[model samples]
Target: MSFFGELGNPHFRSFEGDIPDNREESIDVEGEGREVVPDATILYTAASFTDRGQVLVEPTGPVLGKAEDAPIDVVGITEGSRVLQINPQETGAEIVVIDIHHTTAQGEEREIAGTASITVGDDGVPTLGSSEPVEQLSTSIAIRGAGAQVAADDHIYLQYSLYEAETGELIDTTWPASPILLDLEGTMEGLQTGIAEAPVGSRLLIQIPAHQAQGTDDLIAIVDILAVHEDEDVDDDMESEPTSTSEPTELSSTEGE
Candidate 1:
């Protein structure tokens, strides 16, 4: 499938006509299509008509925290609010936004917004600019590895396996499982941690010091990077063959005679 097809479709739903003032008012979405549920981390782009009728654009990406914010972005909006844009660019028109408030993993209560982006059609979203090209680093053996290609100001999702410390075995059963957000330093740490020490094909497990494991003393993770994929376009100047200085000389009349 084409990369965009793999990404699917994206759509938007609103709980009410306005964006919520507090995080307590948010909503939940379920089933097929994009549903913005309470407490779900979401990024939203909204365009509203100002008193003069010019469109006012306000874009915010926020995490939901409470019931009052059940419907994220429920305030400053009303019925007949025009749908200006949606995310993921693949879901079609099947989007739902609810009004409620909720909290996040960090225990911050805030109003939530609803929007859904899915991978469904077209070429994948384009990553523009060269400031941050997709960065990748492979292990010496090419077995376990982790790397990421990021665009400026883009949120990245990182997933790695946590493992046992002594036996080099995987510890699949645990809380806060799956990949989480990594700060800039952590992102770099992920790229460099085991690339040198782990053998190729051997799963490299990094033991999270109790202080760094987010309050979990026994939590350890095995980062087994199956493969890393990236798209890079080489310029003509960088092509492999050297440029030919002169065209082949026409057959000499004297030689032929």
Candidate 2:
């Protein structure tokens, strides 16, 4: 008799339709196959849309949050196409509009308030221009919704963008991709207070002072409230639990190549 044991570990797996991607970066796309994403990311969830001929993968990487492991939802990838970059954010939102724009003189260089002209491109992605720096946190509702209002400690789905306060440079955004989830507690204090009481389906513009933005320069975030729940609904939506039937491709963090 031989003794045998199996170990289960949480990792990323790539699957197309019902078949798994066994070969290294060998996802066939027309004549050229889909290359593997080189970035170190943990696949949060794997959703297959065979009916529409697509495989939706929501992976988590570092970019737009208070910590290293943040929740970011990128759009699904098609069969023939490849996913090069997958960004991660803990909690945020995105939109293009400015209200209550102002600026104050700081020495010689005047800092802009929350005043900036935003433009939405053909892809429905927003682009923001540079403005003066805002030292105080402020929020404005761009689009109001009639749905359920967001409460304290509520789980919310959001699509957001982060930009430099004065430079208006693109930091991170979930536009043209997918929305991420935040438990309301696993985020910054400014974000928590800015999003609280906002109704669902509403877009908001929030300005964060440097003190509240993890001691970094003042930042601006555009948030979209997609859905909100008071319970642990985001866990169910995440689909993070490992399944025995499927084999996932493990991408581990290894030092020195």
Candidate 3:
């Protein structure tokens, strides 16, 4: 990813004044992208693609509210193009793209806008990420259930979305697919506590903090329990996602961890 000084660098740019009110688009909590053309140096932005496959960057701007190019110091880089940047001045957090450029023999300049996006289900990117390390397990119930309680040893049937805490993108999900049946005997503490905290028919959002995430980043699981039983007495035709030979959630192997 070389730097580019070209006016059309898609990830970032600057405006002498406010971006045209008609052209600007507000970034949602998820992220945003906009198309823009200057009086001369026309440029467009908005839209994201996965980089190395470990993270997802929600594009937050084409109009960053103001123009500032203060260099954001590099904090870290993962195994690939993903870079972690930090601005010493917290107030400088207003996101903007840094145009790195080097002229080519043919007078072409290459640039990496630093903007990234991911649709999840990539190599290891999850549907959700923490953007920062998760320090502790956090659980929130999306939908509460009034059914039977999930015991410490219950074999439960559920659908879930799993995310790696590092890059904060979705890695796996059971939506539109068969639910998983888990024998909670040897699952991780985060999984055990989080699931036990919820009842059958509830949707639980659990954030497995870094410390409990084994050797990987934090694991975030959004579980939707469909049923619970004392044993694996599920209908014979029931196929489970956790143990599915096709695309298994890595958590399946973490039962004893």
TM-score of each: 0.27, 0.47, 0.42
Estimate every model's Cα lDDT from 0 to 1. Answer: 0.25, 0.42, 0.41
lDDT of 2 by residue, 1-257 (tens): 01111111112233223222221222121212112132322222222122122333322211122111212222232212222222212321111100000000001212334565455466445456545577678877766655567886876666677777878887777564445556666566677788899876566677877666655577777777755433322223333322111111110111222
What local lDDT does model 3 show for residue 123? 33
Candidate 3 per-residue lDDT, tens place, 158-229, comes to: 657777766767777765334455666556668777788565656666778755555567877767665553
- Model 2: weakest 10-residue lDDT segment is 97-106
Error of 1 at 176 (Å): 5.9
TM-score of 1: 0.27
Off by over 4 Å in 2: 1-114, 230-257
Separate clash counts for every candidate: 74, 9, 14
Instruction: Pick the lDDT winner.
Output: 2
Residue 228 alpha-carbon offset, candidate 1, angstroms:
18
Compute the lDDT of residue 197 as modeled in candidate 1: 38
Residue 235 error, candidate 2, Å? 12
Instruction: Output the TM-score of candidate 3.
Output: 0.42
Tens-digit lDDT track of model 1 for 111-205: 21111111112421111111111122222221222223233223222334443333434444211222233222233233344333332123332
